[model samples]
Target chain A: MNILNGSAYPNNGVHLNKRHRKAKLFSMLCSLVTWLGVALLGVLLYQVSSDGFKWLDLQFLTSFPSRFPYKAGIKSALVGTLWLISMVAFIAIPIGVATALYLEELSGQGRMNRLIELNISNLAGVPSIVYGIIGLAVFVRGLALERSLVAGALTMSLLILPVIIIASREAIKSVPMSIRHAAFALGATRLQTARDHVLPASYSGILTGVILALSRAIGETAPLIMIGALTYVAFLPEGPMDSFTALPIQIYNWVSRPQQEFHQLAAGGIIVLLAVLLMMNTIAIVIRYKTERKYK
Target chain B: MTMGTFRLVKKDCINNRGTRWGESLIHCGLALCTLISIVTTFVIIAILAKESFGFFEEVSPVEFYFGTRWVPLLEPSSYGVLPLVWGTLSVTFGAALIAIPIGLASAIYLSEYASHRVRSIVKPLLELLAGIPTVVYGYFALTFITPLLKTVLPEIQVFNALSGAIVVGIMVLPMIATLSDNALRSVPDTLRQGAYALGATSYEVTTQVVVPAGLSGVMASFLLAISRAIGETMAVTLAVGATPNMSFTLLESIQTMTAYIVQISLGDTPAGGIAYQTLFAVAGFLFLITLLLNVLSQWFLNRYREVYD
Candidate 1:
């Protein structure tokens, strides 16, 4: 209609304005949507902090969970979480990093190798609960670990193994191929080349993945539950063979109780879990940012 | 060449050959690491098959597959799994409804609208949401979200599926946003430029060019998020009740398959009994559906994703 107009200038300003208005509206909506995540985080933190702050004293951190919420603490659960994370780190990192490096070598494009690749991807997508089932069957019952910390750690290791492997693979893949090729051109063995160049280049990346995996393992409860680590032990675990309850499991037990005070106690447990998670995430970000800046 | 140089070269050659044996041994060790994941898959399959097989022997396949009743623990127990599957799907569907649009919008906003500063700040914060444990979400759903929802709608039960759906939606939101952002960011800038040259608004360029270009990835993100929701255990178990009612109503409590597995696992059913075996059966079904959704997500990206140089 504007083009058909005979005047030098057409009168479609309203139409153009409407289009611009729509664009502006959409831009605002997108910005709002983008911040919804951050918003949710803020709200969640606010809610938990409000509910749990009264119970977040030093005594709460030192005492074992008791029948009374006022006396309850995260001592046993926190220790178990630390023990579990340490065990998982010991078990998952070396294996996850090795798998990533082996896959990156591109040694043989064999059918079996491809199958392993596919298997890892599928494992990453498998629900964490399924890993719990596997833990129940193989670790708890089949191996007769009797719901020990070893069984829980082994199961948690498997649960986060795929995440670590995938992240490490990505990190290794992002290491420019030219670095490896140049090392090979220098007549260095694959092992030597990886050790001297790729390993240094990818260590931070691997650290980030390992931290993420360990953090996931720390927060994990379902697989532990499936493994029947349900003992409400007022005492700390003495060994890997001892039964344990994790922070998340403790929180779950607390939340299930029909008392308002127990709910507050669960909130306190959440604050501790979130604190640990935040610390791990902060370390990951520091490693990532430091290395990223050094490279760039 | 001098004799000294000749001897040094010979020694180097010998050293290289000697270490080759050690290198191959290390290589085998690394290869073993890769094989562990494969072994894990097989063990999962074997366990599921063995336990579920026991369950199927006692309960007829027809009833287990088609029967509407799911009273695995009661007298005169029925074995139909349809309601549990429906409950799981209903929650997944509701979660998808909440997650997809907001996640896509976040993807678009970060990739197309937000400046670098905002993107960097918000992305990690979003990840923090995903990093928080599911049990925390459960606590929030029960204490915060349920009470909040009840204030608005009084008839909504304390253990309704809506609370579970809402929290699961929140739990998977970061994942969806992050995945879809990658997809949208991967769409070549040249397409956006061309759309701009054709006088398209920023919104138009995103919706028509960018989103359409990253269609499969966005769709795959949706699928993966849905898969995550189905496997969500703690939040649903705590927020959604363990009662396996056949009702699909949002106000009524519903038992999801994950919730059922948690129920039986938390119970005192003997390890070898039919009730105990039902956990594996439900888990096997849960695994199959989530696995299928995952594979479908992969297939969507691989088969339909638009490739740009």
Candidate 2:
């Protein structure tokens, strides 16, 4: 009886050891899979950056596109992108901020406010191409903006407006109620209190959110594609009504072509886009950090 | 007389007003913009409905809806939307299949398992994946992922749905991970502690207690991710072949609705033709699907209210 019990003990111990090993193996496998995803992203980034660096020069940055691959540059696309960003920012910021302020300060938690809030959140997640369709119908076709930079910009403004509103509301809500009450006690009206006391305090956060949204707008390609941004504009758009191409559109056009040189050019265009996005995001981060420090 | 007049003027200046017109004006302005945005959506739907009506006048609604063939440019062209819808679903499902597991795992690892240092390094790196433009992902899908897949599955077409789905899955990983992490972090610590006190494994606790608590948020994230995958344009356009086949084999190339839109937008279709009008009709369909998903996500978030406080 003693011998049999001792044998069962070893068997049970082996089974427990195997279970422990299985758990470890499973966890290790999961970790490895996660690393694989990260590694794939890293490798893709490296390839693009490396290939892109070969053609990334001041001339590549400043010159206009040419038929020759060596001489082709992204001047028109860059200017177009900048113009689009500016217009989108101009159109979206005021509306977004006002909507945010209204939601957070003015409106009571009633059905209308709740409905608007829900709509804004839903609109924020609507795929951008849907916005393109809306733009095509309303801006291009109905309003006869006719494939202009303004049409693209307006479309993009609508696209990111919800994001701006949501972020701005969060920023505004973060401001202490005490400050507003103090201003009110000092005989300031609600509007004056919000403008002078609340807005200034929330300015950094609002700016950060707006900048990030604009950064996203800058990288967008689908809506521009839908609204008929040119694929190969030789000259820069002098005004918002002029036909234009953006960096992503140019990159897409190049990459789609069955040529090795065009592929390199596409990579270069991507690098430029990444630089623009990185710059905007960095500024946003800096502002957020500064705001946090100031508040603290 | 001068002192009496001054006192009378001072007393007259005591009149006050409540809720200034300026505040009212600001609210009106916000209301106007919101009104415009809402009206714009309605106008789009109107235009889409009008054009789609015109399209159906040319073809039959029954054929467009249920017919399997989609030859829009051929002799006696059939405008069946099933092929495009099938392509959209298959690619989206493939992407969700890849993204859900990998993204959830990454979120779990970052929120529960990884150290703060690892999380800080990993999270931003993951976000960097998102910041990479979709067009770049298109290029990578075409140049890199396709070739990589071809090596192992030599029979795979160069511009197959699998490659597009994989690339899209990668593109949406950050969005899912970020949202799911937020959900996971919102789960209270007491539940985890209770599980630990019961001698449960960390994995068991995460799977059973924490994940269940965060299930709504997780579902919301998945829905959003799927919406994104469905609406994706560039990468799929570049990688997935423009063929409007309805086959489920990932090895074969297929055309999604967004790709078809991009295809027409690339200028083969003339303005005011059936094709151009069809773009709007298809866009309307795409819009409705995403809108439903977005509304569902919001409803789930509100309904769950998983926050302990």
- Fraction of native contacts under 8 Å reproduced by each candidate: 0.77, 0.39
Error of 1 at B116 (Å): 1.3
On TM-score, the leading prediction is: 1
**lDDT per residue, candidate 2, A15-80, as tens digits?**
656645654665666566667778978789788987788999999988888778899999999998
Mind giving the per-residue lDDT tens digits that candidate 2 earns over B138-228?
Answer: 9999888998999999999978999989989888888888889889989998878876675445665667677788988888999999999
lDDT of each: 0.85, 0.82
Model 1 regions lying over 4 Å from their true place: A1-14, A293-296, B1-19
Model 2 TM-score is: 0.91
| Residue-level error in angstroms, candidate 1, position B30 | 1.1
Give the range of the ten consecutive residues with the poorest summed lDDT in model 1 chain B. Answer: B1-10
Candidate 2: where are CA atoms >4 Å away? A1-30, A293-296, B1-19
